[model samples]
Target chain A: MNMLRRHWPWLLVLVILLAFPFLFYDWTKGRHSGFVLTLMSEIGVMAIFALSYNMLMGQAGLLSFGHAVLFGLGAYCAAHVVNMVKAGTIWLPTELIPLAGGLGGLFFGYVFGWLVTKQRATAFAMITMGLGELVSAAALMFMAFFGGEGGITIDRVMDTSLVGVRYTSPWQVYCLVLAWAFIAAALMRLQTQTALGKMANATRDNFERAQFVGYDPRMVRLMQFTLSGFFAGIGGGLYVLIYEIVTFDTVSAAKSANALLAVYIGGAGGFFGPILGTIVVVLLQSGVSLLSNAWLLYVGVLFIVMVMYAPGGLIGLIFMHLPIWRAGRMRELLLPYARAFPPALLVLLGFVFMVELASFTTIGAAQGKRFTIGGQLIDTTAPMPWVIAIAALVLGALWLRHEARGFRQRWDELMEGSKRAQATAAPKPQEAVA
Target chain B: MEVFVVSLLNGLVYGMLLFMLASGLTLILSMMGVLNFAHASAYMLGAYFAYTISQYIGFWPALIIAPVLCGLIGAGIEMWGLRRVHQNGHIAELLFTFGLALLIEKGVQMTWGLLPVPYRVPELLDFPLFKIYGTQFPAYRAFMLLISALMFGAIWLGLTRTRIGLVIQAALTHPDMASALGHNVPRIFTLVFAAGTALAGLAGVIGGNYQVTEPAMAFTMGPIVFVVVVFGGLGSLSGCFIASILMGLIQTFAVVFDVSLADLLAKFGFVVTSSTPFAEILTVTLPRIGALLPFLMMVLILVFRPRGLMGTRDT
Candidate 1:
């Protein structure tokens, strides 16, 4: 009971993971709901990828712009393995196919890390960017291996199996992905406690001190980079299995940007931050794409806010409130939240209106769709819509600013009162103790 | 011999264009220590702006107007966006620029749609300038070389003979010391950014017609430009020049050569069959890997010499 209490978070996560498929299966009825399963699988895969990225960014303090090379190589390797299996050259379980990608990642990481590890800081970033671009370009030009712009595809329905169980269901694939994700994440966590990982952190904090302590910073970086690449490759392998195709987009700079976004938004400092970030980002991407094309704009704005005001990230912000919450002073701030709601809603509604107007003018116009407002068909060809949007934007900004000031004042007053109450109550308690 | 001569001329022209884009980038990167990810986006904007202006006036007028517009945009971005994020540190600044790049790309697509624009070379430079062993060379390419050379001369003189140029040179080498010496460092940074962006704009104005103006143009050129900047070393104009020329020549010559590793191996009495895994790689010719060579060189240079050839600092 004490052990369970100590590790309740881990136990809770395990239960959640095991119960997810059953819940999903029940929700989807008897029909094979591949979309949700595939999305979940992608989320797990991306989580691993994002965590690998955090190893470099958070642990090693290396900011890479081209981390997709490992992932792409892993995908390509998996594709090749799938082809081989289909050709009856090898008999391996579908669950074990991702290992090929991991090996491929390891091989490339060893080779590339040897070169990239020589440079630190900005130089390292530029070198990785160059290598990433080179590989992606090569993927397009070299048709034999990369299959050109068309990419390479392989049939996943192969009869070759070690356990005599044909991999036909999406659930099986999801289970396999979950298993790998768990293993990869656990190993990565363990790595953080190891000697090399500690040295990597040391190098990140102060290279000169690490060198003085008899550890080569370059070697430490190389080891961490290789391991990160291995995990990234596993993610890529899962991607290929889910899609059954690998393309240049897999290794593009945009994909690297995606990984960066996930890590930053999720909170790079925390181990489980990437998982949170991956889930949020993937959901936003898949969900918001259906409603509007301006989701990226919102993400951009959010990222800027995080960088400027909340550098520790969403989790960090939540953690910052722990002292207040524990002291029971949080209740006093409820009125401020109530006062802030109307203006916040106005700002959100105005922002959404502007985004919708812009999207309507661009993508909607291209699709020949008519704009409608309150059941009245509004002509988008007129400038009235644009004028209204601009007005709303300006008005919304003004309201937001006013409300923000009011919110700050209310918060200060509440905090001051709470502190006074605590101080007065402390004297009474002390007197009683005497 | 004919192919070599043509390729050489073509390579030189392309090299000059690459230099135009890379020089400003090197200056900004070394002096500011911020890898502006939106540099290529500025180039793309220049092309689009030129196309729009050319529609109203002519290509010649648009050429001048486009770069000015780009400079103003750069100045605005620096003043409003970058300066605010500068307090956050290098990574935040980089991320901001990256986000800006993404916005620019999507914005361009939204504005212009997803098709290549009809950006043609000006009528004045439409004809052939010369014949290299019966093969005609475009006059536009000669014009590019002349303009690039003129810009190079201006930069050289500005850096060597002007007072502001000397201040910039000092700042490039020692940013902190220069700032401590009572120079308006922020103003200089903004000027450098605007100037660099203007150069990129000019490159786009001319090179867009030489290449193509499209939504994908930024992405296609962004990496190669970065490679040139890195391979040449940060803050070294001479290194940028040499690397640009080398890359241009390599790319041009690679496309002309069709030999493969397998073919070379056969000459050495090693006959490899097609069934092997290595065979796929071995059979790839030089031309096919042209796009990847610059990046390969960049990686190699970074590994062996992070400071680059003629770079003052490690980056």
Candidate 2:
């Protein structure tokens, strides 16, 4: 009962994930939506990748710009292993392909970790970036491992699944991805509670202090980096199975940036932050990208705003209200939040409207796409829409600012009340000592 | 001999262009402790702005106006965006600039579409300036060299000969001390950042027509400029100049020299086959590996000399 209570959220999430594909199922055709499955699988792979990235950025205070090297190498290894299995050179279970990737990632991670972990701070970042560029260039040049520009492709149907699963369908591959994502995330979560994890945090907070306490900060960073690489490689292995191809793009700086975006936007403070971030990022990449060409612009603006206003990310913002919720004063600020919502939405719509207008005039016009609203064709070369967009932006911004002041006041009052209530409710340290 | 002379001249021109971009980035990185990931975006903005302005006015007027416009935008970004994020920490500042880079790239695409602009050299500078063997060097390249040299001389004079330069130098070395000595450090930072971006804008104006003015230009040039700064050692202008010239020369000459490591190895009686490890690396021509050289140099430098060539402080 205790275990059930503690693990209810995970179980509930599993149930939802299992049921999600049925919503898009073509019952008459007896087929699932390929797009949804691919997107979800992408989310799973990217979540593991982002979690590994947080091991460095959040836990160990190491900012790497070349993490994709590990992931890409792992993928290449997995692809080779799949090819080997097909040639009857090795007899490995299909389920264990990701393990081969993990070993590859671990090997390269150790070698690269030794090179980069010598220095901490900015120098480490620069070295990793240089290494990333080198590897990416090599990926294009060398045909043996990276397979040149065409990359390495594999047929995932090796007919060697441990449980007799043929893995012919995207559905099967997605299930495998989900399983691996769960296992990797669980292992990583457990890793955060270990001595190395504690020492990594300690080193991140105060390297000098950690060193004074007889811990080698460099060793801690190297170990964390190597372990993170192991998980990232698993993600890469799953990527190969889903797409059946790994390209230089996997090892590119852009891929590394994707991991960074996931971790930063998710909330690096908590374990589940990267997972949440992966969902948002993948949704934006796959979903919003289909609707608007300015999706990247929106994501960029959101990232900047979050960095400035909410460094702790989406999860951090939720955690901020914990004190108020615990004190039972959360309802007091609800009205203020409601009041602020309209203008905020107005500002968002207005900004998006202007962006869409501009984009339509240039990129859309080139592609022969006309600006439209509710099936009504809007002229891109006209002045009226521009005027409307500008007016809405200005007015909505002003209104939002006005509401923001009220929201701030209420928020402060509730937070102060929460603090006072918590102080009174909890036993005092000084009294306990006496 | 002809190839050597021409490659050297071209390398010199390319090197000067790199210096123009690297100088600003070095100033921002050293003084502010912010890497300014958007530095190359500023260069890209310069190209786009010059292209648009040159469409109405001539290239000469756009050359002057575009950099000033970039300087103004830099000032606005510093005053509003960076200053707000300054309190959060250096990482926040870096992320802000990174986001700004993405925004600027998207904005450029939305406004200009996803095509290279036809920003060209003026008719007056279109003819050949010199002929080496059977090849003609365009007068525009000469003009670029002249402009860069003049700008370089002006920067040297401004930094060494002016009171404001002295103040900036002091602030760069010791911000808190400069503040204690009655200088507004933040204002100086804003000034330096704007000036640095303006320099990058100047490089973009000249290099855009020489190269191609495209959205991806920022991503392509940004890393190479970073390599220059890192290799030269952070905060050292002289080292940056040397690194830039060395990189430019190496790139030019590598293209000229079609030699391979395999050939050298064979001469030493150690012939390599197709199945050898890194066989592609051994047989690859110098020109094919030219793109990897800067990054290779940077990594080597960082590993062997963490402080860079002339770096006084640790990066």
Candidate 3:
């Protein structure tokens, strides 16, 4: 019963994940939003990738810029292995193809970790960046494995099937991805509870202390890094399985940045941070990018604000509200938040207007397209639009600041009251137990 | 010999430009431990600022005005942005700058369009200064060398001779000690950041004309500048200078040469064809891999030395 209680949350998550496609089956009228499945599958793959990356950045405090090298290599390996299976040379089941990718990731991780883990902090960042660039350059130059920019394509379906389920449909592939993504995420989360995980955190906090405790900090970093690479590779393998194509872009700096953005934005501080981050980022990448050319700008602004104000990310923001919610004082904060919302919306609209005007004036002009959104033309060259944008920005900002100050006062009061109540309420609980 | 001399001159120009950027970076990083990821974005801004200013007032005035504008902007970022993020620790500060770089890149794109600006050399200096082996060396190239040299002299004198320079040097190497000894370290940081950005702007004023000013230029040049800083060693200007020049020469010469590893292998009685194992990587030429050289040097230097060429401490 205790074990069931401890695992109920994970089991619930698993149930939701398993039912997701079926839930979509009704929404999409029996075909399962094949597009949605593809997108969700991509989210799953990126989630695993970001989680593994967090192992190095968050747990080990190693900021690596070239992590995609391992990821890409694993993908390439998986692709080759799939090709082998298709050729009937390997005779391996398609289900276990990710293992080949994981092994490949491990092999390269071991090699890279030897050289990279020796340096700490900033030097490590630079070196990894260089290594990433080096591999990318080589990836383009070398034609055999990387396939020279066009990348390697594979057929995930084969004569061999472990469960006799043909991997012909997007739903089937997605289910494969879901199962692997869940397994990978669960294993990585479990790893954090292990000795190696604790030691990794110890090394991150204080190198000398970990050393004093008889753990070689370098070895700890190396082991953690290698394992992280293994997970990243597994993610890559899934990428190959889902997309059936892996290219230089897989290992490119941009892709690595994607992982970084997800991990950091998700909150590298705790488990499931990457998962939340991956969902938001992938959603933004697929959804927001389709709407505007300035999606990156929005994401960048969000990241900067998070770094400046809330380093704990989205999950961190949720965690911060837990105490207030527990004390049943969450309602006090709602009105203030609602009051602040309009100004925030005004500011966002203003910023968007300015960006759209500027972009329309330049890039849109160059493209010979008018700045029209939903049949309304924005006369970007006119001064009125610019004036309106500036006014909205300035006025909204001032109003938001005033509103925020009011919220802060109320927040402090509620927090203090809760603290006082807890102080008085504490002994009664102990006395009741006695 | 002629190729060697021309390559040397070109290398020196490029290397000096890199040093101007890296010197400021080394000081800020060593002192604050915040690797300002947006440093290259500042350089990009400088070029754009100059480009816009030059259109209205001509290049000469833009040269003086753009850098000052960049300096002031840098000061604002330091005073408000970096200072606020500093309390969160270096990683947050670094990430803030990284985000700033992304935001600025978008801003630049929105303002300037996703195209190269029409920033060019003044026609007065566009004529060839001299010819070596039938190749014309532009007067602007000579002017670049002269300007960089003058800036170098100014910087050298400023750092070694001025009162503010001593405080800056002290603050750079030992921030806490300098702060404890009655110097305002944060102010020094703000000043250093402004000066660094101004130097970057100055480089942009000249470099924009030499290389096209575009949105992508920041990213293209950003990594190379970082490699120079690392290869030169952290907290050492002279080392940065040496590393920059060396990298510049290597890049210039690599471009000039058409030799490949295949030729070398053939000379050693090992013939390579398409069938040979890893033949593509083996046969790729130095010129083909020219872009990878600085990155390669960075990795090798970091792996072996870690402290860099003359760095007294590990970064």
Q: Which rank order by DockQ, best down to worst?
A: 2, 3, 1
Query: Model 3 off-target regions past 4 Å?
Result: A18-29, A427-434
Each model's TM-score for chain A is 0.88, 0.97, 0.94
RMSD of each: 4.0, 2.3, 2.2
- Candidate 1 lDDT by residue in tens digits, A12-77: 886697677665565446744677888888898999999999999988999988889999998898
Models 1 onward score TM values of 0.91, 0.98, 0.96
lDDT of 2 at A214: 99
Q: Record all residue pairs in model 3 with backbone atoms less than 3 Å apart, i.e. clashing.
A: none
- Which runs in model 1 stand beyond 4 Å of their true positions? A17-29, A79-92, A140-166, A294-298, A341-345, A367-378, A408-434, B266-277
Error of 2 at A9 (Å): 2.3
Lowest summed-lDDT stretch of 10 residues in model 3 chain A?
A425-434
Clashing pairs in 2: none
Interface RMSD of 2: 0.9
Clashes (N, CA, C under 3 Å) per candidate = 0, 0, 0
lDDT per residue as tens, model 1, B1-315 = 999999998999899989988888899899998888889988999999999898889998888999989999999989888888888778888888887887787777767766788988988889998888999999999998998999999989998899999999999999899999999999999999999999999999988999999988988888788888888888899999998898899999989999989999999998878886678788878888887788888888888888887787678
User: Across residues A202-265, which tens digit of lDDT does each residue of candidate 3 receive?
Assistant: 9999999999999999899899989998999998998999999999988988888888889889
Q: Which structure among the candidates has the greatest DockQ?
A: 2
- Model 2: lDDT of residue A423: 82
User: Candidate 1, overall lDDT?
Assistant: 0.84
In candidate 3, how many Å is residue A79 off? Answer: 0.9
